[model samples]
Target: GVLAQAIPARSHPPSARSPRMFAWPEKRGIASTVIRSADTWQARSPLIPHEAFRWLHSELRLALENFDPSVPGQEWQGKAMSEWLREYYLESIHHHHDAEEDVYNPWLAALGAEVPPSIASDHRELVATIEVCLGLAKSLVGGDASAASSLKRELAGMMDVLEVHFDMEDEYYSRVLVDFNVTQAEEGAAVGRINQDMGLEGCRVLLPMVVYAMYAWGGPEVVEQFKGNVPPPVWATLESDWLDDFFCNNLRVIRRLQGRAEPELAEGA
Candidate 1:
């Protein structure tokens, strides 16, 4: 599968008609009506990396420990998922930085908050490491057996930097919306801009990754609320199409590989 594509074990809410995600929503005017509870969803975008990075921190360390990539039939699925996950982790970091520098930071400044130079510094350091990890991932995904161990160790070392940057951004980057009382609609507009920036690739990739990865921290309802923020054509079937296809068909093996049990997905049950 392409690295450009990827959500939820909680259940797929039955849509009378499941929408296909062939295109993103056309850009349009956002209603100026103030949105209540916007800050939570506002924080959700940047915080995705916060949660995803933390989760990947452990999963990356566990990838090699749990399964042997060299085994052809026995461990192939695990090997593939591990490789896909590595790529997914890298994508999350890249998108997180894009959101921060392009959207989140300006809002922070608008609110009279200055993003510390160290945050960008940390990003440069993290992104540089991420580039190296992505290379390792490209090799591992390409079936280079040796790449797994190297990628694992690099990620382990990267965690110290990731955790520090996350905490720093919590104080400086993500929290600024609430700190300044940014309205939900206002924050939503910002998210829309991000959605616009993310455009097609984000629709196929980051959207599902965030929704599913979010389950680690926020669970199903959180996914629902987060869905409201996702602007649509994709949103119409975000769960039913992109998310389910990404998770159930593609990522289901990961649960088995990780030694966790998942219910068989019964459509319309």
Candidate 2:
């Protein structure tokens, strides 16, 4: 009913007066489409992304603790710490905002929804914060001990902005999707397209970051949801390689600092 109302039926020639509309792309391949229809389709679950963000928030806090100068045996040095923050910023936060700006918001606008300008403004602010942190991080790369304290402060500020930005995004966009009755299949397709556009190399770096963060924080449901959407070949690569020793090692370090037990690195049958 919502789809029919939002999008008029196909006609001989597209009407000049017809409402601009959005639909899931049909070109991603039949297998993906079928999987989405059979396995992924459902009512929108806004909490999944929200949970992932919360996990990221927690991970950053843990990282900052490791970076603290007052802490005995500082676990993270300038270069390694900087790289970690860069990876999270680029693969997670930046990509997430870019997807909303380029795909999600535009799609809603085409569907005649009034997408809020504040969301874009929030992204800009977040980007500025990220850049500031990154610059501080770069300065730290030469083992500047003094920069550690400043880097930690910058990270804390970034976290503050992220908390508010994520809440706003979840409130507005998630509600819009639910209100419009956007199928999970459609949402999956949109996400799939965004990943595809990133190319294989980009996926190599980003996919694991996303999977690790979501799995570590969002629990089993989020893990299964993401795994189900991944094709078998890609899923195999993620398990066998991308999320291999390095990811597990990082997980171990983070968990140790937080006084948590080591989680099973791989999902079991």
Best by lDDT: 1
**C-alpha lDDT (0 to 100) for residue 198 of candidate 1:** 67
- Clash count for candidate 2 is 0
Error of 1 at 188 (Å): 2.0
Off by over 4 Å in 2: 1-46, 69-76, 212-222, 253-269
- What CA RMSD would candidate 2 show? 14.2
Error of 1 at 81 (Å): 4.9
Clashing pairs for predicted structure model 2, backbone only: none
Residue pairs of candidate 1 with colliding backbone atoms: 38-184
**Least accurate 10 contiguous residues by lDDT in model 1:** 29-38
TM-score of each: 0.70, 0.70
lDDT of 1 by residue, 1-269 (tens): 12112222223454343333222122222111122122465556456556656655555555445655677664464356555655455776787787778887776677687678887787788888888977876776567777766876887788777777776665554466667777878876766667667655555556665555666556656667776655445664465556655554334445555556653443444
Q: Write the per-residue lDDT of candidate 2 for residues 169-248, one digit (tens) a residue.
A: 65676567767877777777777666665655455556665555554444456567768877666665555554553244
